[model samples]
Target chain A: MAAAREFGVPLTLVGDRERVEAELARHDCTGLDIELWHASEVVGMHDSASDAVRKKKDSSIRVAFELVKGGEAAAVVSAGNSGATMAAGMFVLKRMRGIDRPAIAQLLPTLTGSTLVLDVGGNVDCKPDHLVQFAVMGEVYARFVMGLQSPRVGILSNGEEASKGNELTRETSVLLREKPLNYIGYVEGRDVFNGSVDVVVCDGFVGNVVLKLSEGLAETVGKMLKAEIKSSLLSQIGYLLCRKAFNNFRKTVDYAEYGGAPLLGINGVGMICHGGSNPKAIKNAIRFAYDYALKGVNSRMAEKLDESFPKSVREREANEAPADAKERVVS
Target chain B: MAAAREFGVPLTLVGDRERVEAELARHDCTGLDIELWHASEVVGMHDSASDAVRKKKDSSIRVAFELVKGGEAAAVVSAGNSGATMAAGMFVLKRMRGIDRPAIAQLLPTLTGSTLVLDVGGNVDCKPDHLVQFAVMGEVYARFVMGLQSPRVGILSNGEEASKGNELTRETSVLLREKPLNYIGYVEGRDVFNGSVDVVVCDGFVGNVVLKLSEGLAETVGKMLKAEIKSSLLSQIGYLLCRKAFNNFRKTVDYAEYGGAPLLGINGVGMICHGGSNPKAIKNAIRFAYDYALKGVNSRMAEKLDESFPKSVREREANEAPADAKERVVS
Candidate 1:
């Protein structure tokens, strides 16, 4: 309701009708462009993503995507099982033209503003060409959403040097260099949070690990601080005095503020939320989804994919190289 | 000097003799069994690791390894180029018996105490067999050095589910289940510092990123806290009152407290210190290296490898499966 009131975006709550109405009535949502669409079935955490998508036709995630597919909604956002959301997205909205795979682009708070990371648990077994697409999709999000005139893109690796990384990163780095991007060669894990680059692209395995590691580290740090504050009477007194400062610090490192990340390369905007998302987080995700549709980022991404991969990755790998890409390759 | 005095281990300083002697004289070293060994050359950061190993015969890193090779020094510790150290270790000390590749094992402070993570920028490209070796070596370090009777070992992946991993981790998980050690399946990046497991194993690419990400996040959090505390006059006063609590927080999150990690699977004890390590960190590393030598981890590791891999990976891959391993695989 806050999202509709604050962002002035028409909101549609897709879930069990009674539950949705109950939340709206309790919140006293007045003078808001709010609508409700009922989805009888719910996808549980342990439900297999593939099985859920195939069998649960009326599931919340599936029904939400159907709304987008049927032109009733511009975007879909869900704080459900992220895997189910991704699976529903691909099965319903389908992959964009010339896009081989869709990827999840996540926003992380950095020392300086924020940075975007792509392929976070989306395509686990990604080829180098797949990573090339992730970088492009990441670029679009960094530009249109983050409002960067020109974003510095970096590939996540063990070392900063081009000579570093394994077979996958080594190959991906070479491909990224050919793109018309502000490509920084390579970035270490430290660079992700240090604000050295705007977008850090990697295969899903590495990116997923980075996302989870950041969350875990933040929790560990918060718990340690609390324990230390309660160690002595003087420390407990100090905690009371510094409560506001601590609150501000928590907000700064908090991941919930960022809310949902879009599953890019899909036909329409589909935002995947954290399972533990609060009301504020859900509101932020709704606002983000509304903006994603308003900005027409999907069409721009489609254009970029074609312009970047003139002959498509599979064709290029098949030895049928386009003249423009070949010329850039030599240069 | 502190390590020698505190840990009571005889020490040798390997570098330019004049420079080493000047430091010893300035410190008024007396009654300490400190010896200075001269090396005419050095391996700067920019120097290629392979080039240095082959060309720089008298380089300090090479000389230090020589000390171990000749049995003059029980262990070696260096904060220089980590790649150079690994190269020198492989060249002079050599890989241990039946070990296809050696790995660097790092200690990270967890929610409870600490956990060991291995293959941190040692071998970037690793096969499943190599990861199996990393797990075994990590188990050895955790059991012997960490003093855990039986360590809970886990593979780093995107999810805890056995079904959730890339090809490398998927294959590794199957092989790990056949091991005699206490093998927990997949642990996500969150599990590394959450005290969910005693040791986390991964390819060098993932492990290196994890290490750097932890460091970067800590720095980011500290900076955010400082910025918040200085935002207002009230926060500044609060900061003054909470100085000790803040200091305790810093120490708890400080990576310097862990000091250095040992390059396991090498024939001798070689502790690899962080480039930004302080004097106290260096002392801790030196002391840890002394304990590593005294405990005879290298020889014990060899025994473990043979016992675990009755038929070496190469031989097993050649279709000659050992009866012991074959039975375990069926089970």
Candidate 2:
């Protein structure tokens, strides 16, 4: 409803009809371009991705993906079970050209502005080639959606040297160096928040770990600050005096301001949001999805990725990508 | 001087003679048991680890490790290039049995107290068995060194569910569950700080990423707070009012308070300090190394790790660990 009021774009709300209407009714969603598309079932967080995707046909996440697949909706954004959302994306929308698997590219608040970190939990067990694709996909997301010209791309490693990183990152580094993107050699984790690079790419496991850890650390810092402020009478008085400054700091670092992350390398705009996101986050996500569909990011992303891969690299990818990973792509 | 005064452990400072002497001369040496060992060469931050390890034989790090190898020194601690330090430890101190590779375990301040996260940057390319070994080594470090009764060992994953990790973690999780330690199920990155788990295990790539990212984020937050405080008159006045509380908060989270990470699974203590460590961090690291050597952590760690790995798991590791990794173990 906020998205409808703000962007004035028609939104097809897909979920249980009663719940959707109840949420909308809380706000003055009068004369808003909002349509309720009911889906009977819901995908619980504990439900396995594979089982949810295959059996829960009428699940909101599954139905939402179907809307995008059938062109009934421009995009599908859900703050639901991400695993189920990812699985539904693959089973319903398929993938883009030159891309073997889809990845989730998330925008994180950085010192300068924002940076894109890919595969937050799309494909956990990625091969070197899969990581390379993630780099390419992340690059496109930064360039087109984020509107950066020749975005500085980097693969996250322990060190900034070429000789750092695990086997996967090492192999991916070799592939990235040959690509046409503005490939920065290597970046440490601190680089993510420092805004040293525009796009930071890693396998799903590392990206997800970093993402969650950052969130946890930020929250912990907040709690720590509050405790420190309350420890002394002067600190409590000082905190009250500087309450405005604290609010500004919180606003700058809050993840809700950034909203959802788009699942890149897919056939359409499929956003994966935080399940506990507030209305502001969901509203921003809807606006982001609307902008993404209007911009045709998917087709351009596919085109750029296809062009980036030479014949030799493509062949190398096929050989390097493990065969067993293909069967285990559900999660 | 601080460690010597506090712990009364005689200290041997290894580095260029002139520099070490000058540093020690700053403080009173009348009643101090301090010895300075001279070295001709120093490994610069940019020098390759292999080149420094193999070519710079008389380098300070290498010379220091040799002191440990020759039984002249109980443990070796250096605030130098971590890669060079790691390589020197491998060259001078062969790994403990049942541990194919030695790992670095660093202590991080948590809400409750502290949590141990291992393989911060030791072995980037790890097998499932290698990760399981890291878990065992981490468990022993927590129990014997950190003095936890039975460390709640958790393999770092994207989610807390059993079906959550990547291929490496998934396989490692299976191995961890079979061990005799107080093995917790998979833990997300957020668990590293919430004090929900005692020990968090992951490949060097992931662990290193988290460690550095945390450092960067903390620094960034500090900067953000300063900027926020400066933006307003009330905030500036409030900062002076609560300055003591801020200083206390800083001390609590400061890395110097905890000191360097131990190079676990090695024959003797090999402490890896941050390159930018201050006098406080160096002092703490020396004390930590002295405590580790005194506790006979190496032998106990070896015993526990060997007991944890069954015949079948060891065989599986020998097969699963890639052949080429054995050749490229230098870095």
Candidate 3:
């Protein structure tokens, strides 16, 4: 609400009536044009996203998605359960044409700039085609949205060697080589922080672990540094003197600086913020969603998919033939 | 050699004779009982370990393992290529009676003490039984070497929920529960740094990535802090005052302080250190290898495996029946 009010973006708030009213009463919004939409139910952060989407017909998340699907809003930004947001987006807006699976593109802060890692916590088990699609989508995101000319794409692996990864990564590397993108072969986890590449692609399992592990490590390091600095009077003086630089460093490493992760390959613009997002994070997320909608990322993704995946689509269709027949028989 | 000399252990140096003699001459070894063994070939850091073991018939690594296998040495410690060390250990000493795979147990420095993560870079791809065996081996190391009474064991995954994780983690979690160890369910990547568990188990691919990424991130963080401190006059003064504290912090997180990773599940005690290990690191590696051998960790691991995996071994044997039949048919 603060973000919309400050940015002068016409905003519609959706939630339980009393809670929304109570929250509105807490904030000053005298001249801002705002509308409140009542949602009969609220989805808890730990609730199963798919189950909530299916069971709670009038949930705030579902209603928010409905507003977007009805063309009432250009985008939807959620700081609630990430899984629910992805589930709702998939259920309401669906995947773009030729996209096998949707992915979450997380912008990791690097030494130079930021590296975009895809499928951070979306699809756990991914196939070679899915990874190739992720590379194309991540490339388009880096080029069109993140403003890179030709993003260097890399498949996350155990080693930098072409033959170093497991079956998934090895197979994906072969398929990635067939694409027109700036493929950098295989990159290890260290490459993510060193700004070695613009985009890193992997199955959601590895990506999610890497993302969370980085967060945990950064936090732990900060805590340890603070404790060490406070242990002595001399260090305390030093910390006071270097506090500004430390603050700048914190900003660079902080996830709040990136706002939120964009849910890519979905038909509409949706941004999923951390569940513990502050007002600033939410504001930034709203800004990202607005920019994403303005840039028509989804349409460009569709075009890129058509251009890059003609062979893959055909092969996937051939592979699905028997499964489709089995489905038909079951139906 | 320095450690052996200091500890008064009879040391047999296996490498190119001239180089070993030169190194020995460089260090004062007048009273140290030392013997030099000649190895015609040396394995390069990047060479495939298994291939190097096969082709480099008289390599230093192979010869060192042979000494241990021939009961000429209590243990073998190498600060060279880890893959070569593991390969040599497997080829020369082979696996323990019922153990299917050996794992590299890496001790990760944490805020409160440290956590032991197994399979840091041993088997890139692992199965449920492999992970269960890793837990048994890791638990024994933590108990006997690290001296934890009953170590908390966790299977690294994306979430803490029972249902959270990929197929491998889910299966491993089930197998872990069947063991007699302190199974802590699924732990995320963040949990490893948070010191949430005593032993963290995962496939080599993820574990290797996590370990390297942490090293890279720690180095980057230190560099970034130094750059920030030098950016301004106040920070420069502050850094001087806090230099002691910063050094202490660095020591706490330093990989060198942890010595080296032990090769567990092998029939003999073997250690693999970082290729860039200094004399101090090499000394620590030798110390760890000595302790590991003295404690008879391999024999204890065999006993633990028998106690924890009665059902798993039976099931695995049954599962392997078909493969054995296929091999017989082909033969």
Candidate 4:
């Protein structure tokens, strides 16, 4: 909310008016110049997003996505059911032209800032072609959204060797290695935190697992340590003395430190914030959506896709010809 | 170390004779009745386990694994390079009969006690057969080590739907569902904390990522909350007054609360404790190792592998057979 205030974007609350008003009051933002986009109901919980989209037609989540689709809103930010978010974003906002699927690109916290892991619970069965597309989309998104001029892309695999990983990753790695992006062969899970690669691509199944596990680990370890520190009077005093340093360290690993995940390769800007996200995270996601809008990420993705797959099949076929035949085709 | 003393395990100083003697005196263990197992020299920091095995010959780590291998020690315990430990265990002790790959199983702290995530960075490119082996080993280890009977086994996937996960997990899920074990079809990352399943199986690649991320998330959330608590004087005072309750909460989520990961499917009792493990963690790991050794995990794994394979194969083949061939195989 502070980031939104700083950027001077109107804040929209898409939930129950009374509850959201109470929440805004709690945060002292009730009368502090924030707008509410009231929706009568919330989406179904534990139900597939298809059901939500079909049933909850006037739901806040669906309405938010509609606003973005209709260009009424620059972006749609939600901390609702992740599956529902992805479904709504894909169904309502739609995929970018030439892009096979929309991928949830998550920024993971590493010792050296954040690395983006895409398809973080978007598509489970990612084909080789889809991964090639992911590499391109992730690269473009990282450059535009994350401001990395030339983002390094890697296929998350079982090992660093290109031959490693399951069938999907292996096939994807082969295709990625031939892509025009700054492709960095196969990277292991450890590489996600090593700051070696700017973007890591994997099927949504593994990506979701990695994201959740990372979040769970950080929470589990921090809680355990705090318990140990407060167990004794002396340690409690010591914790008090080191409180500032501890908070600093905590901020370094916090999930909200980076904004919400952007649903890359989508036609319009869409971000899925953590369901338990505070106002700060929602604001960050909105800011990200605005920045993405300004940068024309969708157009860039379309251009890249067009270049990869030209309008004329003859030209595409000639370009895709063998290396030796490439000279003849050019001549 | 205090826990070990309390548990009545004879403490042994395994280092340079003079330094060991000096340290023993400094720690007041000189009069506490402990033994000294002196090595010729210290294991070089970056040295391989084989180097320590060959050169120092009596280094603590090497000696401990030797004790387990030679039946001189009930179990080996170490908080060293996990790769090196697995390497040493493989080379020195070898795999148990019928076990393809030895897996490192780590416990993930959930809201409800804890859940076991097996193959947490042991063998990366695990095959379907290897996964079946993991399930058997995990079940035996959980039953004996964790005291959970009829542990629910779920293959970690993108969704709870059986159709989810990669080809590997899908095939493994099919194999698991037909097996006699309490097989749940597929589980999501959140299910790790939901107590829906006792044992969650995945290849080491996913397992390693999940394990580290869980640890990182736990630490991150713990620190964030601690920071929140310390942000205000009133909150700080409240935290101090309720420090005991917080400590109990911390202990609930502590990774060390579950001790260490047992390198299951190995011939001998071997445990891989975290490298950054403190003394309390070391003590707990030792206790887990002792329990594993007593339970004859290796023999049980071997037995389970031998009995489960043909049954699993027959069942899979029967289920997979054409409608006409079904009766022939059954008959």
CA deviation > 4 Å runs, candidate 1:
A22-25, A313-331, B313-331
The candidate that wins on lDDT is 1
Residue B282's lDDT in candidate 2: 85
Model 2: per-residue Cα lDDT at residue A73: 75
Give the C-alpha miss distance for residue A257 in model 4, angstroms: 11
**Candidates' TM-scores?**
0.93, 0.91, 0.93, 0.68
Q: How would you encode candidate 4's per-residue C-alpha lDDT over B119-154 as one tens digit per residue?
A: 886476678989988888888777776788788888
Question: How does candidate 3 score on lDDT?
Answer: 0.80
lDDT of 3 by residue, B243-326 (tens): 898889988987777778888877777788888887778777777777677666766777787688675456653321101011
Model 1: clashing residue pairs?
Answer: none
Lowest lDDT block of 10, candidate 1 chain A: A322-331
In candidate 4, stretches whose alpha carbon ends up further than 4 angstroms from where it belongs are A1-101, A107-116, A125-136, A146-201, A214-261, A267-291, A302-331, B1-4, B10-66, B226-231, B310-331
Please give, for residues A88-118, the per-residue lDDT of candidate 1 as tens digits.
8888877766568888988988867999999
- In model 3, the runs with Cα more than 4 Å from the true position are A311-331, B311-331
lDDT of 3 by residue, A1-331 (tens): 6665676666778888898889789988898767788989878978898765798889888888777777777777788888888888788877766677889989988778899999896588789989998999999999988899989999888888876899889889888888889999999888888988999999998988888889989989998888999999999998999999999898888788788998887777778889898878878887777777777777677778878977655654322110101100000
Q: Please tell me how candidate 4 rates in CAPRI terms.
A: incorrect
Tell me the DockQ of each model, to 2 decimals.
0.61, 0.64, 0.63, 0.18
- Residue-by-residue lDDT tens digits, candidate 1, B275-299: 8889889888887887777777776
Model 4 TM-score relative to the real fold: 0.68
In model 2, how large is the Cα lDDT of residue A31?
90
